[model samples]
Target: MAAPAVVRDLREHWAPASAQEFMLDDVDLGNRRLTIAGRVRPLDDLTLKLLLDWLEQRRSRWPNTANLHLLIHNQTADTTGRASSHWISAAMRGQDAPLEKLRVDRQLEEALPHGPDPLHLAEVFGLDEKTPMRYADSARALMERPLETDPATSP
Candidate 1:
């Protein structure tokens, strides 16, 4: 509730109307990839492990349920529907950082390493063209900034 805008994507992700087939399309463990916005993003070992664990729990808790969503709560376990929007907010109520900040930080992290390749950043993070360019520019500026001189050490 504190950061409502930050959880907009979470709401959409947990929306009851989300296509079950897309959940399958989103993850490919064999290939270690995640598809977001039609972009195939590679999954690191840690992410794969966490996803596997979640999948195991989901299967164990709701083995008899018909819900096919990647994420579901008790309210949705018995049906093909998903958890409600309030559930999404409550789930993230005590998070250390806002989701939007995490997303921006991730983009900045990617941009800092490859500012010269805005296209790659855009593709990797599933971002629009301009956003990546802004990140790339900010990263380049940070990298190219001159170091401050120490008066005490001046010759």
Candidate 2:
């Protein structure tokens, strides 16, 4: 819950590569930042609290374990390895949306508010240099479209 929640809230990638690479040190609650894939992104209050609680539970369950991954499970708790990429999906099986969809929705949410600024999107999301431009273009088109009016009210 905490992992998927963070992914949805912060627009961070939780794909196979990222899921298998997350470390406890990547989350800096004191600084309210998460360093993932070389991107140091801010963490919201709700997400921060969730993480803190999760950490407390983790410590209680595996006090002597040496695993450093933030999302450790029953099988990976004792080793210094990350959970498999499918871990997020497995954990989110009954959730409203998949982790990937959450990330896309988050990107669109950000793009709508900050479109025409692909550079900002790319910088914030660590997207491929050209990827943010696509989202920016979509935002631009959506913004340019006229709003619908009721036929009865139309002149």
Candidate 3:
């Protein structure tokens, strides 16, 4: 039997491409869709983040890098033109209004230049540029496991 394909640790087999720096903007996650500066097809935000993190890591190691991207749509109004507040509420489980609008830009900043922030990822994983792919992989894996009230913090 052929040996199972060994998936190399992204850190080991990863190398950034010699491509121009691609700009990512107007990212709207309200509906988990994004409209990249120039591209097509609505990409999942989580997927984009994972790829971006990997690319950034590779870039740090290899200055010359190439990147790929796809445009996505954030459809706020539904097919019937109804507000998504009801859906959002149902998703939040009657949580505080402020909590519902939680976007952790600052939390992401803290998690960078060191390593993953267990405290932040413990709640929700953000595929922001600051995150590392290895960290993201671990965080996503942990989602399946039982939640630990107390999570480790980045030093």
TM-scores of the candidates in the order shown:
0.72, 0.77, 0.21
| lDDT for 112 (candidate 1) | 77
Compare candidates 2 and 3 on TM-score and give the better one: 2
For lDDT, the strongest prediction is: 2
Candidate with better lDDT, 1 vs 2: 2
* Model 2 TM-score, 2 decimals: 0.77
lDDT of 3 by residue, 1-155 (tens): 11101101111111111011122333343444434323222333444565455445444643432323211112311122322333322333443533312333333333453345564443333334444454544545554566566545523
Q: How many Å off is the CA of 75 in candidate 3?
A: 15
- Write down the worst ten-residue block by lDDT for model 1: 12-21
The CA lDDT at 17 in model 3 is: 19
Worst 10 residues of 3 by lDDT: 2-11
lDDT of each: 0.63, 0.73, 0.33
Give the RMSD in angstroms, all C-alphas superposed, for model 1. 5.3
- Supply candidate 3's per-residue lDDT for 76: 18
Q: How do these models rank on TM-score, best leading?
A: 2, 1, 3
Segments of candidate 3 deviating more than 4 angstroms:
1-33, 36-79, 94-102, 109-111, 114-155
The number of the candidate with the highest TM-score is 2
Q: How much is 90 displaced in model 3, in angstroms?
A: 2.3
